[model samples]
Target chain A: MNVAPNNQIPNSQGLVKGMHEQEVEIAPGTLFDAEEMVINMGPQHPSTHGVLRVILKLDGETVRDLDCDIGYLHRGVEKIAEHDTYAMITPYWDRLDYVAAVSNDLCYVGGVEKLLGVEVPRRAEYLRVILTELQRIASHLLWLGTHAIDIGAVTVLLYAFREREEILKIFEDFIGARLTAHAFRIGGLWWDAYPEFDKRVRDFLKILPGRIDEYETLLNANRIWLSRTVGIGILPADEAINLSLTGPVLRGSGVNYDLRKAQPYSAYPEFDFEIPLGENGDTYDRYLVRMAEIRQSIRIIEQALDGLPEGPVMAKVPKVIKPPVGEVYFSIEAPKGEIGVYLVSDGTTKPYRMRIRPPAFINLQSLRRLSIGHLVADVVALIGTIDIVLGEVDR
Target chain B: MSDEEKVTPPDPSGDQPQQSETSGEKSPQSAKTEASADKPAPPRAAPSDKPSPPKAAPAKKPSITSEIAGDPFIDKIKETFGLAITEAVQTLGQQILRVNRDRYLELCGFLHDNETARFDMCTDLTASHWPERSGQEFEVVLLLYSTPNNRRIRIKAPLADGEACPSVSGIWAGANWMERETFDMFGIKFDGHPDLRRILLPEDWPGHPLRKEYPIEYRDNEWTDKHIEYREVDYDTSLIDVKYGERK
Candidate 1:
């Protein structure tokens, strides 16, 4: 095993080395030395999903060390949370996980609801389930698109985004805004579902399964797609558990844990759906799990629409939310994973402390472990398989 | 082992007496008699004739508080570890325990591995700044969860000016970035963290931006040299006199 020499080689002439010299004389009093190749992956790389920079210390193609640099998109959301009142902060939640705004809203509003002890109406709960499942589909669509693009598959991106656009159009119909839809309020929804909301949802339900079939037709059995994804970035169940990986990443590793099923919330128990599990625990498994999840989410949405009860959306919460002096931590099965909101209330409208348990942030930790010993090119595939949104990661 | 090495009778004031009284002691010989008794007997004295049965070893009892109390895993952890838990707040299967900074990691370690209070998942790490709070001005909160147990716990450690808490990154690899973010935002140091850097702020940025006292803006006149100095110019613009410029 011919390893390269640890130190710079001395030139035959032994002169103090210039820029191009084979060796350079050590500066006096230098006590320690090591050789490492530093590589900066991105503040703008495509696979990073946002302005995330990973500085890697590499031994040839293997990553020996990784330092993740974030905050490029830090809009000071926490500080903003402090400044804004409970009602006003909903918009900030929308931007945190822009792909799945409803889940973000649920995590935050759920905590606030617990703090205020307000019971949302059954209709509102069903509405929340419908919107959140729709948002989950939308989010997973974006993930499938970007993750495919991160790998060499381009057609999936186009097909996934096409379906995602339909979900956004539905969002636009429900709320005036689409991308950053602050549709949820503390007690319930910002407004009632539009008169055509049910019809539009049913319309999507009818169309989406075919669209999902379209996606599967394009990618699932394609030899190239299977070759790229199957058996790549395989995370063992124990390692996944130890790494604290969540969402589909954990499920792909054969963990039968979904917060919606394990600990039901917001009428999730009322709906009938299967908790999808994977066997191989690889990138292909993750893709299959998410694809199945999208289908399941559609089933949930259809159920929510058929059984959509009639009543007020907002519960009769306090005009001003002044929860008692206490703390409450609420978590929801967001599109990515477990999104948690830890709220400490001192009987004030503003929380004493608000902490967000971002799934992307935790999910990203397994990257280095999965990436090591693999080709540098595989880094993108591994990160894609993890399916992180840097907005949530940095937040 | 000599007779002196043989175990002696436990003192009446020892913890075994209290344990026996609470658990209702039953030796194999006494088990049948106790089972038939109408009412459970109080703590029974060791027989006077027989060598005092080696202080009945404390029963290997499962954690009853955790099973019965329905406390969050972390609360059960604090109780089991004997860590002083102060100002507990509980709601919706979530618990927050305020603990001194000194014992934060100890409590975290127990919670991460303990059978009953298995907070195997460290979900989030964050800090809150309170400049006006008297004894402790900075509060670091660790949010944890157990998928198996279906519970959440918040462990809060308060620090003064220079105190540091042991890092939980060893227990949960996910805490690496989170602990860095906490350090970046609140400047609360985790003493044994492998690499602690300002995660969400530039390395050269002045002061912790999230600190209450850190000025949000800089005023002019006493600017640092780095701010004052512009790029060195070859020639004064006013003195130049030529089609292109005066040669240096």
Candidate 2:
């Protein structure tokens, strides 16, 4: 059998396309010194988090150039939003980031409310904070589990999912769904807390800190975990911001910008919490940052619950939602990063154009920058660290 | 629509003008003039003629509120790029500037590097199609934020149907995928984009799915016929209809 030339490698579809067609250049010494091979990592690989196909150009074991081919989970969400009414679109937002459905719902709901200028009641505002903070913790826990599992620590997945199940049970009790809980309305929450909602939340919160500590005790000092994670995929602060990275990914690079603080939305201003920053922007520092964020989320949720006000849950919003002829860009700090909704309403029942600034989509762009010099195995670590959801990225 | 019962106080009383249909035309405020300039041709702003279908009771509630106001930041932008900025308004406390399409890249570079408004982050880049606006139909919106200044400004550039807007991916690297997605959805071109191709849809996809002319439901397309192999499984829809009928 004849071997293909260096430039004309087969792609994911088995089509013989030139690697140069993908706009990646072969490094100077890589062409003459060693034989170069192009390989596809995913679209079916479990460690990719979803159907993310990364075409990596390899020189021996090192990655020379990489390009991501996404959109496998593309559902044309923005196109669909143009046809649906304002109230009907909230469910679709839940499907964007299935793990952090509550936060996605809050971002979309807040954007619509901002366009309409409807002020949510104090009780609803407080409840929104509590639910979103709980969602942030839940999302971080899932990331912790899956990221660890991807890097060869199978025990963490079981431990992390155990705690995640408790949070999902709370979600099921509150909103009647485990995964995609559309727990918010345009103006406020659909239903107020159940009778034992407070007790259930408090019980979960009580056990959360201890559970987090147990995960730390397992992985913090483990030699194998440290060998695989620490000092891997280090992204500096300036590059992270230039790439428009957000959430914990930006925080891990020591950038002190959190939407909850930089531009406070919802009832976050009423509650007190700290924005955690990492000194080194590596896989381990990102891990520490997310763990610290989980604790801070607990603090915010506890404060919101203690100061939960007494009033009507829903605001005085019109039944047929029609925002004025204007455009509003509303964003909230979601679990993976900053999820924004750019809404344009032409004074109609349906949106003229609805664009989602998905954080994972932007953060995933930095994978090329982070994984270029590392081994092929580190590409998995980098993807896990970025924490992308293909549904949101491709939407 | 309770403007009086706002959680955040309604935009300092003196900065905003009294509510009226002709407020944008009547007021001499630079912001109002900019708002009025935006109201002329675009179908999005010309919502007055075909009034929205009447609502039940809140029809009397004011639909148009004058939130446009001049700000010091906007003044600095206006001073730097005089005619490049065609219109400027602050709606719902969002500072929006409509720039001339030819000078868009220059304006973006200025915004990214200027001291007053260092919009280092390009939050998003997407286009809205208005087929009714014949000459200039596509509106490209760029949402930018300053990490150092903790402020955001939105820049909108109007482009013709097949016109190419200058890409800002060189200034902000994250715009590479966003521009590709825009190209994939609306079929808008971004000049000087390093890799200007489809991001979401397949390379062989049929049409720009987000264009105004495209239908929402799925139809037979060339890409599907080529890629997806069909195994004809007779999943009965009549059974589903019968179950739903029984439940009803």
Candidate 3:
């Protein structure tokens, strides 16, 4: 609601600026012409999810141009990674995409394991798959709730949070932290499945489908929700690929590429699940795609838990962890997109360069393409649709 | 040198099944212990006949070759763009190609348009600063993924301290911000980046923090003082001065 920059404009102000500004190449006798106005949307607005400041050049209500001004939350995470040891960096990875900390942890640890060529235990891989899938579901639920509230459906937010709280409870019981849980170690997990881990996940899975059904019942056919999102912010398949958009946003554009399906890692090859595709590439389609992904996540967790392997959870990693001089790129399908870690080791305990290929950071690039012609109100919905976390974007 | 020596001697050769995991741990440990030795460790005692040394010691560079004959993809790329690829190396199942900085754009265009390798997504673009390496102080790394082929390759271009590297943002739209981030962190210039301003740091911030020589805990007190307004506290008179605030 707070507009930080100057919003007031006079007719003479445009003429004063036109003298110094570059001449526009306009077709002769063009019927459509409008003066452009620039305004700042947010570095503080709640609907932006976090400090995502978008400079919007507006031609009336329609967005003429959009530029995102990020780095409000930059903590130099990559710089921090250089100083921290491989094992010490796991907790920092959790802070990259705080919403899907488990998935981020998986990517970093898996990258380190791949660099070391250490074979993780079967039990640990299965447990990792279970926890990350749960994280995907939790992340999608938070997105759905916040996205719905951004549009106007207050009821769905309540229902979504109710279910999300349950997942957080399970995470608390297992990993001792709900949000930024450093759920993984360098070689494998720090701990095996707790006594109630199986039962807790099974119970959640049993009720998740019904809860998903309730969400659909609330929003699928509702006129208000459909009107706000149905045909708004369309990104074509080819354009999405060119922009390197991933996760549900890319899937919503009908691109049939998911890292789990494309490049299977951990115990993902063992369990079977489908990557739901959206045809229209609209905000509504993206919404449907993410909702379907939650259901698929439940299916994956059920499979992983049902066939849980029994072995040593932690692999025999050296106390003084050091990797070879070569560099390795390891990626996994995070809830947001393809979260990858490109680690360069100079045969030392600390990484020479630790570059986290943040999915939200890349996926957020499509915001300009998606929100160009949309109205000011729809920009909020588009930002929500992208599902960006400023922590990862600014890191 | 000595680090490799210490890690190699501890490899349990008798244990075959767990050797892969244990050898991985020991070889790196041994390498660290024998790091000060004269000669580099010879591939870590060959516990399971691993291909390369356990770790890349500072003394020994990873062996690289320009001739990679077997793989059809590398062969085709080499055939199309002769001499552009300076060296090719396969380390731990990851294919890395070092390309000529002058011909970098053309190679990227070919890779994106080529039917066999339709690398639709420019997965990531970043740079690392190696101050110890003379002349080529920064290496810009690109991780490209061919969605159809489901293959990933790394293209690295080495540059002198302040030299400009050609940008790939023209090929992949996602590379725009990535190039900006790389420039912001490593002070490496991208020749044709659309908008190459600092993306992760303040516009007025000084020095690239990701450079190897930059300290881990650097504080920009100058910028903070310029932008942030604080109540002027006189240590001579203020009760909260360090002299009075010190605990006995």
Candidate 4:
């Protein structure tokens, strides 16, 4: 047994800070000698988006085999949830996938609501739909920017961020927090939607539809963009479904299993929108799905705002939420994929156990399968297309 | 946007039968034809009017509202795995089965096969520790979803400390990472998992942190000193000097 080695510092092997540089013999790959190189890509690298470490075994430019070494960002979130009150647990879920914190809030709160059997206020349901859809669009905007940039389109990053900033501002106006917005309460919203929340959302809906067209124009015909992404990282539909993939990755592979449509939650059934799926489960198809989702999210926001209900957003439930002994699993169609909160409460104010089914963690498991035949450079694109938040993956 | 442009959630009136399988329902070459000029490809096509396969479970409109106890899906599970399931109940509008660890993999396969309950996606695999139940402290929880029927079921099995549970990663590939994470947190071993190493924690980290026995705050700094790299400079003396003006 290679028992727990006492020394903490992972052997600072080949350590020259700025970059991994090995001036070793570049064995000219003749028929005789084809040496494989095992290189570590991140736990520090910028393109990884966070501290994700993937150990790749490469034969020249082609990746021979790869092992993803995750967990650098693990903060014992589930352990922490066990100790905190049910109300406090919702806020921390915001940190799981910071980009779509509203979706996280809704999933956590939805479980609690189901366990309590509390009927949410009709107005709150609409508010939840609007805020979640807005957050979905916001999250996909970030994905579009990063995924585009990963494929070497730097200009799209600037354009995508320009719109995402407005969505964050709307969040800041509503909850006093932007990225990690803890805007949900157990029974309903902690506070009513800011009066101007409607206006700002409407404003975004007006301009974003046109802006989405702008993005399509920029990348739809660009030869470099199409060639780099079109056929890269082809994940077969069976392989994708077998991997328990969800959200865009699964949809891009032509599976129409969006939870919002398959299992309606909140006020989603009332609104009208479509689930955009792709023909091929490649990087470009995933990209197309997310882009269409932004449009669909906008459509949902518009419908929700148009048919805005007028009532209190908070449900009449006890302040100190101690539901009867029971467990409930509430899942929703989050921007990335299906996010669920499995809550087990033992008639206590604090949750006995809360399991977060992070889509990124489940979706990320398919990376090794997707990256098998692709080149080393395409790995970045594959990572981007999956749109994983390390915080969620490690949590 | 035209009238066709507006895509609503599937009608709850039972107009279109649900798709049966969880995934890989589409062939590899399957991609919807590109949108035509006359009518753009609606983001979500109307639910295929194709009828679903024969199901013993009635089409109880898949809504959070109208939650019926003794769902047919639960009945099918109880009927199939009677002895294995120690406890079966309907709680919080969803069905739950608490089974023994020995027959877990068997149950998973039965669920995956189409003849019985064909659960397509294993949404999650996690565990919770109950220190009060000293003998059976760890409880592994699996959340499974049936996409075609819009049904969710939870399977929980109890395991004593250091006892191994059969791995379901074979039946559901999504179970691979999930089982590893559960093993990492609760310290319950999986019988035949491919890579059962600690996933979220360093392999050398002491004790499972999610267990109730593990201290939230480690005052001893024993585990920290052993695992965290701070060899070059001792912060203890430097912090003391900075805090109280030169610790003479």
Best by TM-score: 2
Docking class of 2: acceptable
Can you write out model 4's per-residue Cα lDDT over B1-248, one digit (the tens) per residue? 12232223233323243323312433431343223334444434433422332231245323232333556766677677888888877664667788888888888878877655668778889988877787787888888876666677788899888899998877777788898888888888998877777788877777887776665543335667887675554344423222111211
Range of the 10 consecutive residues with the lowest summed lDDT in candidate 2 chain B: B1-10
Instruction: Select the stronger candidate by lDDT from 1 and 2.
Output: 2
Compute DockQ for each candidate against the true complex. 0.17, 0.30, 0.30, 0.23
Candidate 2 residue lDDT tens string, B1-248: 12112212223332232244234444445454454554334454434422322331244445443434557777877788899888887778788889999989999998888877778888889989988889789999999999999989889999999999999888888787789899999999999877787777888898898888787655556887888798455554453322211221
> How displaced is residue A99 in candidate 4, in Å?
1.2
lDDT at B118 for candidate 3?
A: 89
Q: Given candidate 4, what's the lDDT at residue A15?
A: 29
Candidate 1 TM-score, true structure as reference:
0.77
Cα deviation at A275, candidate 4, in Å, is 0.9
Please identify which of the two predictions, 2 or 4, would achieve the higher lDDT against the true structure: 2
Q: lDDT by residue for model 1 over A203-298, one digit each (tens)?
A: 888988898898889888889788878888788776676566779999998988798988787999888999888998988999999999998998
Which residue pairs show collisions in model 4?
Answer: A279-B31
Instruction: Give the residue spans of candidate 2 off by over 4 A.
Output: A1-33, B1-70, B229-248
Clashing pairs in 1: none
DockQ of candidate 3?
A: 0.30
